[model samples]
Target: MALTLYQEASCGLIAGAAEAYFSFPFVSACLPRVDPTTLSVVLRAKYRNIFDALYSMSANKKISALWTNAGPYVKTRMGTNVGMLTSYNPSLCYLRDSCGLSETRAQLGASAVSAFFGAACSVPVKNVLAQGKSGSSLDCALKILKSRGPLAFFSGFSRQFALVGPPIMILWFAYENVRKL
Candidate 1:
């Protein structure tokens, strides 16, 4: 009935990849509208809404433009899911068995650890994605590196992680507890 770490990681990776791919269209449409730096791009382009953004992008550019940074998006998603999923069981076991924590406390601890790593893994990519940079993911990456160096990716990590960490912790905590039932 239990899944091994390999199985868990594989499941997480596949799920993350699929989620990113399927959601990229919506994400691509929304990011420019919300990201202040890119909001002007949306406004000047006169995209009224998500549909307008999608329509304009597909009409003016290749349909593939809709998934401009999908590679990095999917990579980040996989890292986050793998961080959460792969760490869950081992961390849970360590907390409960080695650390002598109660079921509830151990579950909470494990979930916290998982969320921390998941957010850590995704923060850099989120920064890159938020920039709404044009080009393939790799090109965007190289541009950032050329302009700002490698550490540029982690630029707003602390603030971003603070915002995202709690929600992800709550998510894993709820999922773990609910799975028990």
Candidate 2:
């Protein structure tokens, strides 16, 4: 489970930041505004924030596919996503448990993938919501939750204790700091 606030802040910050950088409105004009009522709402919000951070960080464009499997190295990239994150951080957990790696090595490997996913997740939500979806949307959100193998959405996440957690502590600090300043 993710820290609810980080999930909220991560999504909101990324979306707002991405829009600020790209100068494109990534929100749905007629999508009933945004109401953070459920998990989907939270994720939708996260997508928006991540997008902004991706743009704000000025990260490379090549990793764009990792956001949604649109790149040439998508499989490997996604595999890295699943491989590194599924167990624990790609570095610490994988090496210690899966590959018998040392602490340093596993952390390094996981850090790399974390950077990629962090960047990708930080991407601005380019997919605008339709007034009513011109076509049947694939419910990618649901798909993200349904899979069991390879692209297993967010399942088998025995180790996903904090999907996007620590950043939240930073958020609370920042919130306090900003308000004071």
Candidate 3:
């Protein structure tokens, strides 16, 4: 069963929210810190480490979840939908036309491609948040590239892809099932 556009968007939004909420901490930890002093302070702080880490790892999140979490999550979710569609369309075309796959197989293959693209696109956004930078995403991206090198964008990619892929695949699977109903 094919999902209507609204249903597909809803599924993507829900999945993105869940992914962002659950993965934020781990994603933050994986980013490279510009200030080594911050890491040391957090480590040596013992019981205060959590607070220290949170403060350093995010944009003064102690202030408000809306600024620190929800806002970014929504932005990330919207970005993800764009990334998915960008990748999915091309992958679907390749799978169907080049590989001569059936419609179902093509969709599944395209979805897998979309998941990888979405996860890859998310890395820089996560890096920006982890660094507690309030700049535009482009500015943050350039900062990462300038300060940490091109690889900085992919700092936690392996871990992130491992964590992100399943949920994406599951979301698509569930979306398909729901559309059938």
Candidate 4:
């Protein structure tokens, strides 16, 4: 019952779309807290917590404001999921069979590979979101290109890779082992 790469990508696309749509509001609310520079741009007022932030955003700008960057977020999620899901199993099999790694080591290697690839694919869109710049994804991308150059799209890439890799490794390690039961 193994999935083809296309099937994996399809699954990833649907899952990522749903995840981005459902989570965008909460993510939008929390972003200003983690990246305070966004406060003046996004909220203009500091709230005590996420719920309060959501409430104020909805009140001040309408509920739709919470999804301001939905398209870009969805693109980021889809890229990450497609990159990870498409690569993970083959990477695992290669490490396990060709590299002759132990189960734990194979899972770890595969997850790290998947995470790095996914982060690389998604980080450009993520940078756009993090910047909280107005306009469509294309417009924002163009602005960044004109102002900061292509590398600006990957400004925090190493930090993002570090943040993404370990969680994915832990997840794959745990999930693969448990699924064997």
The Cα local distance difference test for each model comes to 0.78, 0.38, 0.67, 0.81
Over the stretch 38-153, how does candidate 2's per-residue lDDT look in tens digits? Answer: 52542232334645644533346454322432221232223333322332333345566888876555555555454444334322121211211343334643433354332444
lDDT string, candidate 4, 58-143, tens digits: 88576788887578778888877777778899899999999999988888899999898778767887888766557776788888
List candidate 1 stretches off by more than 4 Å. 33-41, 44-65, 123-156
Candidate 4 — what's its lDDT?
Answer: 0.81
Residue 117 in candidate 4 has what lDDT?
A: 78
Clashes of each: 0, 18, 0, 0
- Candidate with top TM-score is 4
Cα lDDT tens digits, model 1, 1-181, are: 8899889989889988898898889887776544446555544365788788789878967888888757867877887787777877889899999999998899889888887777776776776665645766677777788899988887876775686668777887888778889
Candidate 2, residue 24: Cα displacement in angstroms equals 17
- Which regions of candidate 4 are displaced past 4 Å? 33-49, 60-62, 124-156
Model 3 lDDT-worst window of ten: 39-48
Candidate 3 lDDT for residue 122: 73
Candidate 3 C-alpha lDDT tens digits along 73-165: 665665566556466656777999999998788878887888887778776667776665667778777787889998887788777678667
Weakest 10 consecutive residues of candidate 2 by summed lDDT: 123-132
Q: How accurate is candidate 3 locally (lDDT)?
A: 0.67
RMSD of each: 5.1, 16.1, 7.4, 4.2
lDDT of 1 at 168: 71
User: Which model, 2 or 4, shows the larger lDDT?
Assistant: 4
| Least accurate 10 contiguous residues by lDDT in model 4 | 33-42
lDDT for model 1 comes to: 0.78
